[model samples]
Target: MSGNEKISELDKVLTQFNVFGRYHCLFMFWSFLALASNAVFCSNFVFSAEEVSYRCKDEGFGNDTCTNMANSTAECSEWTYEDPNSFVAEFGLACQDWKRTLVGTMHSFGYMVGLLLVGPMSDRLGRKLSIVITGMLGGVFGVARSFTSNYWLFIALEFLEGAIGDSCSPMFILTIEIVSSRNRLLFYILCSFGYPFGGVLVSLSAWKFTYWRTFLRVIYMPALLFFAYLFLIDESPRWLLIKGKKDKAIKIIEKAAEKNKIKIDKTLLEKMECEKEKSVNFFRLLKMTFESKIILKRFLICLVWWTTSTFVAYGLSINSVSLRGNKYVNYALTSLMDVPANFIILLSQNYFKRKAPLITSFLVGAFLCLAHPFLPANLSWLSLIMYMASKLMSSFYFTITYMFTSELFPTYTRNSMHALCSSLGRIGSIIAPQTPLLMHYWSGLPSLVFGSVSLIAGLITFLVPDTADNSLPDTVKQAEEIGKKGDLKKPAPDFVIDKDKDCSRL
Candidate 1:
């Protein structure tokens, strides 16, 4: 057979293995576990260090009626918390309540550090290995955090957890790399389901365990299960091919084919070869990204969108403790909003295109959040409803941005751009915890700030090109031409086939 025919046959055989099947499903299940763990760790601090109603330890003050004690000369020294085991009560952070927010800020700071380090590390090592290392480290630190006797020790551990706890993004990239184009959106949604599922797990655990230390220990135990499951999986074939490990890549394909009960013809497999290209370092990638006006615009817009969405979503979530409702139930309800958010994105992604739904979600979410301050205090229920609605829309925007950003960049620099945007997004999260402090000045200041930023971000969404059904760009030049013709349904460029065939070139 001619070389072209042999290459064609190889492509067909690879597709047979790549079809959405048991292999992909299993991969997704494991990936979901990592994502769920991320969600749990990221939000668990909200409950662990939860603020509780407390009063002075003055002997004369009645436990039930401390309202009048504040006016008296009784010094407010020792305190009692509604949840005695909460970090605030245990560590006496009540008078110094500002320190409580730092628990989450430290974790986010660690995540920012991780993003800067891990993305490039994954490129040098392998995606699977990076996840395993980071996951195990995050789990270890998370477990050890429960044992810290001093507040500073606990804070230190939380920082480590934040740094290493970022396994979800790498695992996410791996799932994208392994799946077929047709299954990409479905796989992304499935993996994202873990965030809400983890939130549900957090709520259930908090309700059952009540004690902060035990809650931390129990929530982190799942990380071990996810780490163990990693052994049963293979590194991404796409990454292997990119590293010029053709034999190893084929073995993974063969294993998947065997598990999926498909036969791969040996002759066709022989024609498959990894095509190597000049290796681009992180610095070079950054240089190329900034040099291209199209990519730079998309990058900056996405950075802002990411920062805004994460800021609002996490700000609302952490700030829920201060809302006039049962904190646990409020958090769970907000977390559960992810389910409907996913469905909304799934329904609107194809029809609305990337830019429109994102803009709508941000604008609507902003309006609700901005209106929150104006509501009468008697209508606390109304404010709660608006907060939940804002969370739902922010969650939707967060989910869509993941896919939207992936579509905006070429495969060669996709991971780097994602990591950069995510790193910048962490700035929002880090700032979010501190926003609750604004309530001292005005109860609704945080909400107003979050909403206004989101409104501006939604307006900036117009600058990003719509990527509804467009093919993934394989080169910077192709990515630059994405929206030039102004047709949403423009047939994907001829590079689509090349992207699938020339994985190494990407």
Candidate 2:
């Protein structure tokens, strides 16, 4: 082809990306809902801590002494680290409050299970169906959680919420799949900002409605609305292309062209249409991820990063309510850090590489976690600053992980592989709540535990290849070939392969 022909070809591809219709908007809306879900669920940690403390005090079983551990029993109070047993002896129900901890862990476990299944299903059934199904399940469980009177029932419902509601990861894959390659990371960051932003909402809700059940209902309402709204959106064209649905994929591309006021290339459509039919199996996707040697290494590195981030991130977030300060003030202060963190993610993607930011953030989080415990009680200002630093790091890692995973995999396994990595992270979350209970036995345990985990997470991040400026891959062969050739060139414009080849790519 001539240079003019190539320029025209590139322009058409760019138009194909830019002119996406309601599906793009729908992706953002669901992202907001995913974030809102995280926020609402997280606020429960704060709300319950306060409620439990107040309940214990009113029963005359536990004293009103405010521990350095926030809403913990009097024996663990900053004014007197008299040992947890003394407080247990004073309060009958205080020690057995493992119900809250168990529920949180179960939720994470549920998320892990959901993550395992959702990604492959998205690849098989399409992003729109996976999202709608999970969103509906999440909404139903969220409301059910509000009505449960038994602790076991609440735990079961929380587990269900985690298991079914993780459509967030798949939704993330679909969102990035639709945007331009250059803006992919920024869009991921922007979409993810809703989680912490939802934290602010949770705080506002707690401030308005003191009861936890009422707050949960309020949090779930938006997800229910989002579910209703998602029905109008279409499936991802990229996913369609990979499924060998050439006609459907071209239709989406044409719609995008129409939306952008550009013309489609008849020849390119004709070329894609000539491809052979291909089938994608669940085992084939898994084999593509782990069966190969080079990509397998990449997969392991990605898994470690996700696990470390989830563990420390949830550990700090859930334990923040127990930190030494007013529950309301501490939560609100930490939640505010998410704004600047989101800003940094958006701006940094323009100027910096993905690996550097993620590694630096994890290391920073480690240091902050370590420092928080040693700081004297008199320096409340300094302590709060450390807490905010930890939060900022978590937020940074969370955004980058989504972008990084999406970029690393081929389009064929993109949704499933991303979901698989995320599912492992949820496993980390399942273990995170245990940190506080585990730390009670050791001195300055929360700090030591989180600090060590963050440090390890940062170091493990060094194992993955940097994918800054690379074109997104559409197939396992392309991704593996890139690694084999060591062609770390910034990714080229997305290829519009034939339909039959697209399935092989998927």
Candidate 3:
């Protein structure tokens, strides 16, 4: 067989192994850890910069103006914080609440900027190196931030950590790289379960360790485990082949085949090794995006959808810091919503078309958010239920955007476009921390903003083409013709994944 022909048979060769072989299990375990770490790294700000009740040193807590300075610190010569070890109290940041909000904004900014740099790094360097290196850096800087006495140093570490903390995406790419067409969704869901659990871990850790430093130590010290991944995890064979390192790719796959106790077709593998190298660069990604009108239009729409999803999703959890009930419980509940959301989304991918679920999640969430503040004090419990429900919807909306965005563009540009959309979407998370500031203007202002943007996004979602069980587009013309003519090209058997895999077993 020719190299091109052997390439199509690669899937056939891989399917000969058990679905949950030793090599696959090892990769999944590491990817799960990386994902959970990403979650904690991003959401730790809620506790690290948590609100602490404070009063002027001279003014007693009984004073009318000194009750709770969560929103406004009101100039003071000295202060008494309920938790001296809290983020604001530790730094003597008594008169400024903006500094507290800045923690999340700066970290998100770092993540946004880092997203652009890391995607290219993953492509040029390889997937496993990107995950291992970034994962290790996030752990090191995170631990350093916990020990720092300087506020500026803490803030700088926040940005540095966020910038390099984007290992989840690379981990995701690597997870799918090893799986065959039939089992990709199984791996995808398996890895994503780690994110929700990460939030629960952070909240539980913060609840146990009230002090900021202790809480951080409890959260980040374990991240040191990623350093071990360098020796433990294998490099991606597919990435190696594309980069013309066929011998290295072959060696990894041979090991995997052996661990799975499956014999390999040396003849077929030899032909694959002969395939020509295909290189991808950021310049090509940029050139292709700008060169196509349909993709450009969809890209703009995707920005709105992605921005709204991140804004509302992150806003709900960030705002949970100030909820009426148990802080840890509220935060955990909000974060935990992702569990059901993922399950529902997984079901949607199999049973429903993409557009309807995307639209309903946003619209229903908007309605719940819009109605939240209007409830009477007597019905506060009902409001809390609605809040959790809204989070569930936002979680579903956020995950589905990723799947839909990949289908909107051609095969060549799909990953790059998705990464671009995700990077730019961090803008929502960047601004989400300031909702506490919005609350000062009107307690309901944040909800109003979240609801309004989500409403607009749902309406805009109608314009997006539905990609139910359709084949992914392969060319610019085929991409533009979606929702009009049928698929211009069928998907290669290599990626014709079985979408109806049983979710119950997972």
Can you give the lDDT of residue 378 in candidate 3?
A: 87
> 5-61 in candidate 3: lDDT tens per residue?
344455555556454666676666677778888889999999888877777666433
Full-model lDDT for every candidate: 0.76, 0.67, 0.76
Two-way lDDT contest, 2 vs 3, winner: 3
Question: 315-392, model 2: which lDDT tens digit per residue?
Answer: 777777776867766677677777798888766756667888889888988898888889897987888778778888
lDDT (tens digit, per residue) of candidate 1 on 314-419: 9988887676667778788889999988877877764666788999999999899899899998987788788889899999899888888877876556676787
Number of backbone collisions per candidate, in order? 0, 12, 0
After best superposition, candidate 1 residue 179: deviation in angstroms?
A: 1.6
Clashes of 3: 0
Work out the TM-score per prediction: 0.87, 0.82, 0.87
Task: Give the CA lDDT, 0 to 100, for residue 169 in model 3.
Answer: 66
Q: Candidate 1: which stretches are off by over 4 Å?
A: 1-20, 59-77, 80-82, 263-277, 376-381, 485-506
What is the C-alpha local distance difference test score of candidate 1?
0.76
